[model samples]
Target chain A: MAMVDVVVLVAGDGVNRAIPAMLLLLVVLLAGLLGGRLVALGVALVAAIGFAVLLPPIGSPRVEPAEDVAALVLFVAVAAIAGVLLSTIVLSDRRRLSAEQGTVEALLRVDHDRAALLRSVSHDLRTPLATIRAAATDLQGFDHDPAARTHLLDLVIDESERLDRIVGNLLSLSRIEAGALLPERQPVDLAELVAACAARLERATSKLTVEVRAAEGLPLVKVDYSQIDQVVANLLENAARHAPPGSVVVVDVERVGESVRLRVTDQGPGFDPSVRGRLFEPFASATGSGSSGIGLAICKAVVDAHGGTIAADDAPDGGARITVEVPIDG
Target chain B: MAEADVVLIDDDASLASVLAVGFESRGYDLRIAATGGEGLREIERREPDVVILDLGLPDIDGIDVCRHLRQRTTSPIIVLSADGAEDRKVRALDEGADDYLTKPFSMPELLARVRVAVRHRRALAAVAHDEVLSVGDLAVDTAAHEVALAGRPVELTPKEYALLMLLVRNVGKVLTHRAILDQVWGPDQPLDTLRTHVSHLRRKLGGGAGAPQLVTAPGVGYRLLAPGDVVS
Candidate 1:
């Protein structure tokens, strides 16, 4: 309406006002295109009144009143039609722009995840492989020295085991990422499972002692045996890796109504408070131990698949504690 | 007596060769077969005292090979596989493999398992012996379901007793944590639970002053050492 008034005032008395009135109609239509139906209707009404009152005095041949009225009606109809057409185009274009932006953002996020995964894999894999190669070479060079030979062999064995673990974690993570994990659920004895995982860790890391405590007569939890085993094993491994040597890694299990809770607490340094939120995120290693950094993430995935929750926190006793709670029902 | 004959069937040539060197150093007759068919043929040619079969064989399924071997021979079969899945281990055991070892296993651990498997097989074939196994002051009556330390009967929970019994039966032999869990607490018991029970059993039996000791092999399993038996 303001633009229409400006055009009408500028085309006063010196010239025929028909061209300026047409320009005023164009301005109203543009306002409607950008501002939707309400603004377009408001502008159309204002433009019609302004042209009715101002056009005749500025006409070249002193036009009659009837001609002026017909001209005013024609200008209003044309403005309304242009407003509807342009408004539909504008609205559809806005929707399309937002949809395109969403796709681009998703693609960029996927690309970022891929790059992080590759960087983690390359770095983690190279470390143990390098250790193994170096140890193997040392073994050959130190063959005559029995004690040195034994030490080198031990290094080789340890490095190979580490490599095995990293590879296994990568495989499990990929499976989880790809939505390929289909857990075979059954009645699982949580105490027994915890003990088994601890025992395995105990065998692998002699310096670390794993202690298990479970509530008396804890009910059986329904979960996939192997996947759950991996979850517990991964958690125990993470605790062992971070905990001080010879310190006890305690595993506690209890029944909480319909859910069973499994908590693993270590005696090592607790996680950094700032990184606690990202503790379960893949490739978010606090220790920078060249680990694949997917252990806790895998635990999270497996627990989620079983309708469970997992969390990382500082233990009351000054170490990292990871808690996993899974429902007993299907 | 002649050394026990052993056969290892695996598709991993590097691992197989390294294991061959390890076994040869230990004074056992080691034979290698790269495929399941070759493994079966080798087994048919000579009945080995123990057979080590890798589940991920090149020619045939390791479980099928284990099944076939079990059908033909009574020899103990140890299944080696890279898969750590519980079901795979259970299935391999169900197919008559006496023991299952996941890959990346240390040579000492593998050798210990072989010894246990061989000892177990020999014991099964021997004539019936006295039901009581006495190691120093610690005595276990297999027939009576009793355990005694220093002339006094020691009380034990059912799980504890079961665990103690397994160790007493396999005295001086390293029992892998998995084996202990499977035999004592059924196939699905937790590993840490086994440790807890072992701790309890140790406390009850008493570990000093001439009593038999349950020595842990650290990352392996537990072994019951008689009073005079040195743990090396």
Candidate 2:
């Protein structure tokens, strides 16, 4: 009889029965809200609650336990289905976002690679062209006077050398960008490499005296011989350009713990104060005219890729000093 | 007699024509190849004494051209590149180019390399002298310009060999910096100029930097010592 009375109340006036049923459903729906499926499964739970409350009571006397159990099962089943759907939708959205992020990153890398290639290519071409022009221009001056022939020939020689440098830079940049430039790691003698670089620098620049301060029998470190050679050469050349004519460009190599440190210092104007913040950034040269600005950037890239560190600072002697540190094992 | 001929390849027509005229005035026969393909064809058809190859080419890569020429021809290939980019020189040499010249180069330097290439070619073909000029364990032929130490030949550049010859001729005797410069480089050469050339010689003749074969007199001049006389 009690069960029958409960059934009668459940089947009473639509508003009275629906209100209590809705309140009970709200309590269950809180689970969906807590599960982060509020937007996905909340509305379905409200409909189920309304149906449970407003349906007319059955004419049969006592409530059928079987029927009550069946209705409850239906409510739980629908709620579970809603939760699953909500979870699937959330997971799919996350996957799409991740994919989009990956694409953007790939695009950025491609753009950077392309930009570096174009800059290096253009720079390489300009060098040879400049050489030819200088050589021809000097020759023209020589033609006006045969005595000037020797001087004009000298100009041609210098420019041809310049052209060689430009080509080397372009090829190096390309290799770095392609990620194909693997270092031939070996137990390198820092003293030997520095000496070679300084010797070459002196040969290239008639006015500079390169002084090397590397102790003999320095322990060897693992590094790509040629790439490090290029880095040293670039630093020496930069020093030669900025240093006063006939001044000494000092190349110092020392051991710091398990790492080797090499520093090239010149008696020239140091980096511009304004550009110090972006020192290793590509195309960050203060001199807007006739400078490639790729030198430091290349140095940074090479050192970083090798898990090394490189820095530039104004020397106490009113010049610039470039210091590079490479681990012995790396 | 005309000077050694050179083939220069570049895309800049005006610059090429100008360089050709310059070379002509110096009594060299200049062949201009504006494209990489053209340069390769020229190298194949008529091998010039020296090829001034530019890295930038319209049709093909300059490095590829350099490699191809090195594979097929023994002609001295000099690479021309821009300033602040010297890494290419090593690569070109590794790829078989004889020497490299950077842009904004003086004309005198160009002629000097030209002379060196021509001299090297002559040395390779002519085998007149077989005796090795020995200094300590190190030996080299003055005429043949071949160097060997401990029975192994030491490769040297044209200028490096010349500098070594001058030093060896005055072995154990300190040659004044001025005297050495005037003898190797022309008169009116700068004082500091000798140091640069000497540094190159020391590297090639023996181990570089603090090697025992060449001794720097610090402010006076330099002396080439035998291997036994190497200072620690």
Candidate 3:
């Protein structure tokens, strides 16, 4: 302001002082940048009054009406253009800041999950291996005790199965990601598949009751039999782990339009509604239960291969309901 | 069954050693061959009671080996396949391999599959065409076309009768869905039809104290388990 004032005062001829026009022009741009046309007009009147009082001898600059009006119009046009550009930059800066914030949040979440996954994978793998090691070592120490031998052997077998499940799921995820798991579609009886998975898991632990219900003549879905079997088995594992001991984990299958929906309902404390979206995320179940939290993620991948959809929700009667729907024809 | 001979054709020495120990404990003789050529030679030297073939060999295509082995020997071949290689397993079955088990399979599961293959081979050789084929209390008297469970007459359709006869012939062996569909209903039958028929067979021949079990191997096929068969 002082530099422009010095230049304007040195150049002004008092009567036809046109240098104040430049100062008025700067004020007009700031007015447009700050407020709408009404406010711009108000600021212009104040600036003109200030110029008249503050400069004194140069009462008004460029008193010729035609040239003065033309200068004011030119100043308003320049002010509006500068205002639009400046506002655009400011708005864009705000948007960029928010986008960066979102990226930081997502990265933090991924980092946390990666650490959680590492912790979970280590626990899942080591717990079983440690149990098997202990049981096998103990069997060597116990001399000719049949009961102890049988118990230790069972521990070895059961723990080995647990380890196998974890390793299998992890390997499957990599294979699936590599596009190595192509679906070999075939007609399958979902009930039979569930029963087999349930039977296999039941043998490993007789803790939960599995009741698989598929209508006698339910429509057979065309899916990759092996992959779909794996998907259902993952769901069953999740349900079985969550369901209380001696409670029934209900697995039922039905056809809805072109899709066959399979649901797993557990009697244990179900998931919170807010966790519905993240249920299929890897390591979402990393609660230190020695389960491969990657099961649900693998299930999602397999189901996706069949052009299917899988979701998690709170069951009506209080428990988690994990539903998988695969098209009848893939 | 006097200790049936088991041949394992796999390069993995760890599996061979473990299975050898298991077979030894069970009084079965296990002959390990590390490649396809050696496996074929072993089979030709003296056709083993059961051939446990690995579908991944260093020398030849495992499926081709399965085909050649099928051509040379009538002994049961149980193909050992990798976990995700369902296509290879099915192809081996189509190439006349008797049964298959995925790798990383449970020791007990592998043993049971091997036992089934051995029992089926021995049982088939001992009695090729019997008038009355019975497993547990369930009998299919092909002579009179009579089906009876524990002395009670259980009537079945001709298709069911034929299916039961086929399963009876290969007692403990797991017949693939393709193999069963091809042999039973000719070809080009929907697998759903086969699954429906099998489920019906299971429902009628229900489980109890002393009844035969029609077990489904999920994505694979069905096997009829009698009391003394496949008990490893």
Candidate 4:
């Protein structure tokens, strides 16, 4: 006979008293599964006493002390065994549940991040595309004067360039994430690199004043020329976007110990305090506008690949200053 | 001088047609080639005044085309490339391309580059032997190795003088940063050095009223305004 049935039969009146003892054993097992051994033992002791008192007289009018003692002992033994067995099963099941929940939460987080990325990409790309379309439509519509036509063409060109920048940033960020950006290093004169970057930027736009200052006889650092150029260019462009009109963007380069230090300072409102820590994180833009928001991130990746460090902080004069230091080879 | 002929080498049909229309409106003859092979053949056949080459080509590599063209003729080659392709752009300039325009460039900007290229070609052909080249009040005496603004002698360092002389010689022509670096500071010199000298030259030349302004082409190069050229 099954253990429960055997216990039920021992009480003699199987219908009323034995069934009650069986129910009490089930409750004790559940308490052990949820609350451990101490709880299960306490419950079992209380139920045993209750069952002994409440059970109806099992046989003829005379109650045998030995038989009654045996019945109570059987009830307590079965309850304790059931409680111990269920506890292991319950604990393992709980562990499996938590593990599954962790995986589910991770998947949800990835989905959320992907959604945010798509939203940001679409918003950044659409603005420039819309401008280009509008400008093209205007160019085709009427017999405008040469100057007016040129103005519309300028708009189209500028907007397209903006779109190109966004696309470039996206590709660069993806390449970086995929671990494909292995910089091909060469001995590069940091002063010349900064000047070339400044000159290129100056040629693109005439508004901001880009002043370059480098210590004479700065040491040449080994770096990928093109990648370092992109870094400087990104910083200058960021400064140009944030700095007030007619403000100066200063690019300073110097030799610090065994490393080359380059700093780009812009006379702007300074780093946004709220997003300061995450400034170099992908998609963590301070403007929260049409910017690709990966400029600083790219700089950081390129710098890190070169065994260098980059940091952003507020300048003493209340402007954004970004500093990059790369060790120079002997 | 006869009307200048321009050859554009690019695979993008839409952009070519648009550029052709723009150039035609500006009174230049425009011929479009769909591939680098066709472009070289066209250049060889027509010997156009200026060649506008696209860096990304369907057949031969753009830089190779530039190197090959440099061997064949001295006609100015203006490269068209996408933005952020600075390395390739620099390589093209090194390969003897006179100037370059980043893609999505305005028609006016392209025209400006063309004008600079054509002017540079003419300047090369003419090869002025005059002792003093005058632009407004700025005079550069090649023989004396001196510069004077408004008849007053301006003392300049050798590097600054060399930079000024280059701009004066190529007045109204945009000299690429690499080109300036090559001519003034030799090859592999840093661009910042060029900028420092240029800034000092600009200040000494007087960018104030009635002075010949040292105009910047931003990302391309610098040009010294000719006496008759408008400041804008």
State each candidate's clash count.
10, 39, 0, 5
TM-score of chain B of each: 0.64, 0.58, 0.90, 0.82
TM-score computed on alpha carbons, candidate 3:
0.43
TM-score of chain A, all candidates: 0.73, 0.61, 0.64, 0.87
User: All models, DockQ values?
Assistant: 0.01, 0.09, 0.01, 0.01
TM-score against truth, every candidate: 0.48, 0.40, 0.43, 0.55
Worst 10 residues of 2 chain A by lDDT: A1-10
Error of 3 at A136 (Å): 7.0
Candidate 4 residue lDDT tens string, B142-225: 989988888889999998988888877766655778888988889999888988888888888776555777877666677777
Better of 3 and 4 by TM-score: 4
Task: Report residue A10 deviation for candidate 4 (angstroms).
Answer: 4.0
lDDT of 1: 0.73
Candidate 3 residue lDDT tens string, A109-179: 98996776665676567545545554554445435256555755776787688678888887887887688
Best by lDDT: 4
Encode model 4's per-residue lDDT on A1-330: one tens digit a residue.
Answer: 335553655556444566777788879988998888778888888877777765555433322566666777777777877786678678888899999999999999999988776766765675455446544644564455687577657756766776776787788788897999888889999999999878866733345799999999987799999888889988988887677768898899999888999999999999778779999997788232335477899999999998899999999999999999988972
Q: Give the top-scoring candidate (DockQ).
A: 2
**lDDT (10s digit) by residue, model 1, range A240-297:** 6667778998899999879999999999899877668887888777232325578888
Q: Compared with the true structure, what per-residue lDDT tens digits does model 2 show for residues B31-68? A: 99877788888988887888988765646767788899
Fraction of true inter-chain Cα contacts (below 8 Å) kept per model?
0.00, 0.22, 0.00, 0.00
Q: Which regions in candidate 2 have their CA more than 4 angstroms from the true location?
A: A1-36, A48-87, A90-94, A131-153, A170-199, A202-229, A244-248, A252-262, A272-311, A324-330, B1-232
Q: Relative to the true structure, how large is the alpha-carbon lDDT of every model?
A: 0.73, 0.67, 0.72, 0.76
Interface RMSD of each: 10.5, 7.7, 11.6, 10.3
